[model samples]
Target: MLPLFHNLLLQLDSASGILRITLNRPSKLNALNAATIEEIRQAMQYALDAQAVRGILLTGSGDKAFVAGADIAELAELNEIVGRRMAEKGQEVFCLIEESSKPVIAAVNGFALGGGCELAMACHLRVASENARFGQPEANLGLIPGYGGTQRLAQLIGKGKALELLMTTDQVKADEALRLGLVNHVVPAAELLPFCEQLLGKILSKAPLAIGMIIDCVNAAYDQERHGYQTEANLFGRCCGSADFREGTQAFLEKRPAAFTGE
Candidate 1:
């Protein structure tokens, strides 16, 4: 069974092995608050542990936003210590999403600003709608992005443009975001979830073990303590030892489709 949340909706398509997590606070534009963040952590944990879930798709309930930002009222109540704790909590949860073994994609339907943008960046891939807008506008509120945005934004785009956006508090339209590599694809708002499913379907068809290893190796590239090349080699060896790898090679030789059981 799927985990229930007060601020989120979880639906899993067993045939596709895709778990869809919809941010349901449409009245507040699905703003991220402490409660919502905790719920996301719990939901993500469930998705990761569920054997039937091959991929995850994240989006907001309405067309207006994936998530606008953090709740302003919540922010207003933070002191320096509490603010630091909040930032740490958000970073920890977002890191869980980033390091997930299963693929997690963001279907950005509309505004993805501040914490929202950070959340999107944590996903393995992002597919944005034509009306989607991305920004790290925390500067406008006398703050900076606290949830890995400063790092991921620069890594996705570049340091120069990321700095420009972060410092200027400028919004990037979907087309521009696509051009800058912030999103993998941009489609009509109505096609957002469909496009994401199509993309995930393609990815999920591959060997699950290899897919997870690729995720691990790619993430290792950004980790200062890890050697990317060594990590890749180790993961490659692991894949070669997996049952799926043997099935894949044998299937190719036999001119038949390989059935990977994720073993």
Candidate 2:
């Protein structure tokens, strides 16, 4: 059963081990306010704790926007201290999503600007609708992306392309985003969720423990302090000692499907 969270900023539903979380502030273009940010953090924690939730699909409520940006009204009220706190809060929440044990896929339906774009980047994978748009428009506001966008954006695309987008505040169409390696796939708006589900379903069929390990290892690649190869080797050694590994190898030799218990 899916836990019933107060639906102030999000609509949460679950089925077949897949949790679908829709950012629910269409009237506000799904902008991230303080309350909404807290709700998202709580929702991600819920997904992480729930054994039934093997994967997550994140999207927005309306066709107009996946998320337009952070709430400008809220931003207008921020003093230097408050502004720094707000950025830290957002970064913490997004980091939780990025470091999740289960795979989280962002299905961008429309505009994903500023914090919206950062949110999508935090996900394990991203799928965009044909009409979706992506950008970091904080430069126009005399601000910079504070939710790890400066880092993740450069990592996904190259440093030069990321710098151009960051400096110019250029909005890229879904096709261009795909070309830049921002999105994994671009489909019609109507098919975005279904496409993500189909892809997640395939991943969910694999050994869950290995899936988690893969997430950990891949994330380590982007950590400047950690050597990616060393991380991978450590994880590989750990996997070799797991029951799932034994079962997988045995099943391979037996020419049969392996039943992974996630052990």
Candidate 3:
């Protein structure tokens, strides 16, 4: 089912230089059904057009689940050919999340399993609520994460932990997730929103072009070879010479909070 506010997988609002995208369907524990997937794709399109939006915060509608996983029922009936197509589509959608110019942060509030883990991993960063738990339970169902889970999880948490999670199909507690570097921050359930907002406050104030460049360079580093460090160096130099650089430096010298225009 579509969200009440829009034909989106979730609730989206643009305010304070941030876009808060809530994974709706609380009644279903916010599972990633087909409609939810389409809605997420639509939300990404909306983010592309809306100038006021800067950062994206992805979270579940309630405290019970971020997303249990993809709609397994949908996957059960697929044969070889259709399953391949489904995997391809899922990859495209997740790549769109990773490659978006704006910064994307996943606020994992509850159960982030399988595709849920992939979704969070696709984002630039993740923060979780105290109640959040994470896993890749695909092995239990005689499957694997179809949405870049194996690749991204290894990249974020190192190969050992990724393999462990995949092999054991066990869920880790929120603190364990933090220690493993799967999530940037973990806070009390009550403080989840405030913590996410605080993190975005810092990111939203940074130079927009620089942030975009950062994403480009990081993705390049992975998309190909270690040669991307050269590109990173070049972009760093460019940022140092940009207008935001000047404004930030001058503000520092003036001893007041920098009034960054994101120029």
Candidate 4:
């Protein structure tokens, strides 16, 4: 069952274990206001706690934008202290999405700028529509990416390219984003969510625990202090002790499909 969220729509496909979240403020081009961000955080937490949720497909309502950017009016009211707090809050929320146990895929159907771009970067995978546009246009507003965009964009693409995009406020098309490794797939606008669901469905069929461990290890690779190899080794050892590992190996020998309980 889908729970009601003030600024978002949540729908869970129990059979597929895929949760679809739509950013609902289409009139504003689905801009990320504080309320919307908080609602998203709560919704993500709800997804995490729901046992039936195996994967998430995040997108926005309407055809125009995934999220154009942050709500400019709200942004205009920030003082230095308030601005710092807002940035920290946004970082924390996006961090949760990045660190989610279940894979979260961004189905970027249209304009994804500033926070919108950062939001997509936070997802484990991103699928964009052929007409999708991505940019960190905060430079034009006399600001910069405040929600982990500076770091995540560079991580997804390259530091040099990320800097150029940030400074120039240049928008990249879906094809260029794919070429730069910013998005995984580029599909027709109508197929965006379906493509993400199809890809996530395949991933959700695997051992859920192992999938979570993979996310953790991959994230560790980006942390300068944490040795990714060590994290992988540790997670590997843990997996060795899981029932899913035993079942997986046994099923391979038996030539049957393995059933993982996420234990």
Candidate 5:
């Protein structure tokens, strides 16, 4: 069972083992406020802990946005010390999503600007609606992306282009975002969630442990303290010790579908 949230709507599809977490403040274009962020963190933890949840699909309640940005009203009140803490808090929650063992895909239904774009980038994959617009426009506020956007944006696209977007505050349309390698797929607005579900359905069918280890290895590639190759080797050895690995090999030899228990 999923916990109730003040700012989110959690629906666990038991048949598909996918948790759908919707940011529920449609009146605010699903903007992230401190309450919303904290609730998201809680919801993410629930998804992470639930054995029935194989993956997560994150989106907003309304058609206008997945998350337009952080709540500017709340942002305006931040002092220097509070601003730093606020950034750290947001980053901490976002990193939880980034480093999850279970796959999380952002279904970008519309504008994903500022912190919204950061949240999308933190996801394992992003599927944007044709109407979706992505940008890091914090510079307009005399600020910068505090939720790992500066780093992840550069990593997702390129440092040069990232710098251009950050400086110019240009919003990349869905098609342009795809070309920039920011979003994995650009489908019609109506098909955004369905497409993400279809994509996750395919991934969830794979060996769960291996899927998680792959996430770890890929993330390790960007971790300065971790050797990606060594992480892969270690995880490979770990996978070799699992029942799923044994079943996978045996099923491959027998020409049958393998049933992975995530063991």
Candidate 6:
């Protein structure tokens, strides 16, 4: 494990089965630089393999900008090949996050635009502060979202709304985001952490394997023509057949809240 550092803005912590990854550049509003991206990817992979971690939380430092955007300086000099590589790498990392076994939640405190919004959207679900604003502003920068933004945005909101957001480069407020189903919950900045913890707690209280299956099913639900639904049904049935499911059912019948072992 790496020791925490001041300049090294990415903060990683675990408590009560929740491992948090905070983009630590408050001075710069937690912008995703290449270094930051590498660190984030590393932290996520660590949490993915760490048995002690069952749920993950991702947020930004300070009260503004979960991630303002990607570090533009790093991309300013990139050629076509380099740009393509960066996009591919970002997509891979973002996909890994979306498909992580441990459910990851994004706590958006402020302006989550461009890559910032993309990062939040990559999480299993988003919980935003009342002041948080979200957008995919790459179009305005003469660049498209390099992460999974283009695909995932449409999956989260509808295609029409996603296109509107992308084309207009307009930031959507928390209420609008909630209405669009972009965020699960919206609370004041003072309560952002607690709100995220509450949602994470709800997820942690369930069977771990079941949570994983549920995430898989929901992500699949976006593709109506694909075998996603069938796959989800099959996985759901398999979970129902697990020992954890049996114990959970028995516990329910015995008038007790089930303690799922996630077997």
Candidate 6 global lDDT = 0.84
Which candidate number would show the highest lDDT if scored against the true structure?
1
The CA-based lDDT of model 2 is what? 0.91
Model 3 residue 184 lDDT? Answer: 93
Ranking by TM-score: 1, 5, 4, 2, 6, 3
Per-residue CA lDDT of model 1 for 4-104, tens digit only, reads 89999999999999999999999999999999999999999999989889999999999999999999998999999999999999999999999999999
Considering only N, C-alpha and C atoms within 3 Å, which residue pairs clash in candidate 1?
Answer: none
TM-score of each: 0.99, 0.96, 0.90, 0.98, 0.99, 0.92
The 10-residue segment with the lowest total lDDT in model 5: 1-10
Number of residue pairs clashing in candidate 4, backbone atoms closer than 3 angstroms, sequence gap of 3 or more or interchain: 0
| Model 6, span 1-263: residue lDDT tens | 63354423333445667877788888888888777777778888778887777788898888878899987788788889999998888888887898887899998989898889988988988999999999988887689898988898998898999999989998899999999999999998999888888888888998888888887887777656557879788998999899889988899899999988878
Question: Which tens-of-lDDT digit does each residue in 161-242 have in candidate 3?
Answer: 8999999999999999999999999899899888888888788777787888889899988886556889899989988988
| Candidate 5 lDDT tens digits, 223-254 | 99999999999999999999999999999999
Error of 6 at 167 (Å): 1.0
Candidate 4 — which residues are off by over 4 angstroms?
none
**In candidate 2, which residue pairs get closer than 3 Å at backbone N, Cα or C atoms, i.e. clash?**
none
Where in model 5 is the C-alpha error above 4 Å?
Answer: none
Better of 1 and 4 by lDDT: 1
Residue-pair clashes per prediction, in order, are 0, 0, 1, 0, 0, 0
lDDT of 2 by residue, 1-263 (tens): 44454433333444558888888888888888998888888899988987778888899988989999999988989889998999999999999999998999999999999999999999999999999999999999999999999999999999999999999999999999999999999999999989999999899889998999999999999988899999999999999999999999999999999999899
lDDT (CA) per prediction: 0.96, 0.91, 0.83, 0.94, 0.94, 0.84
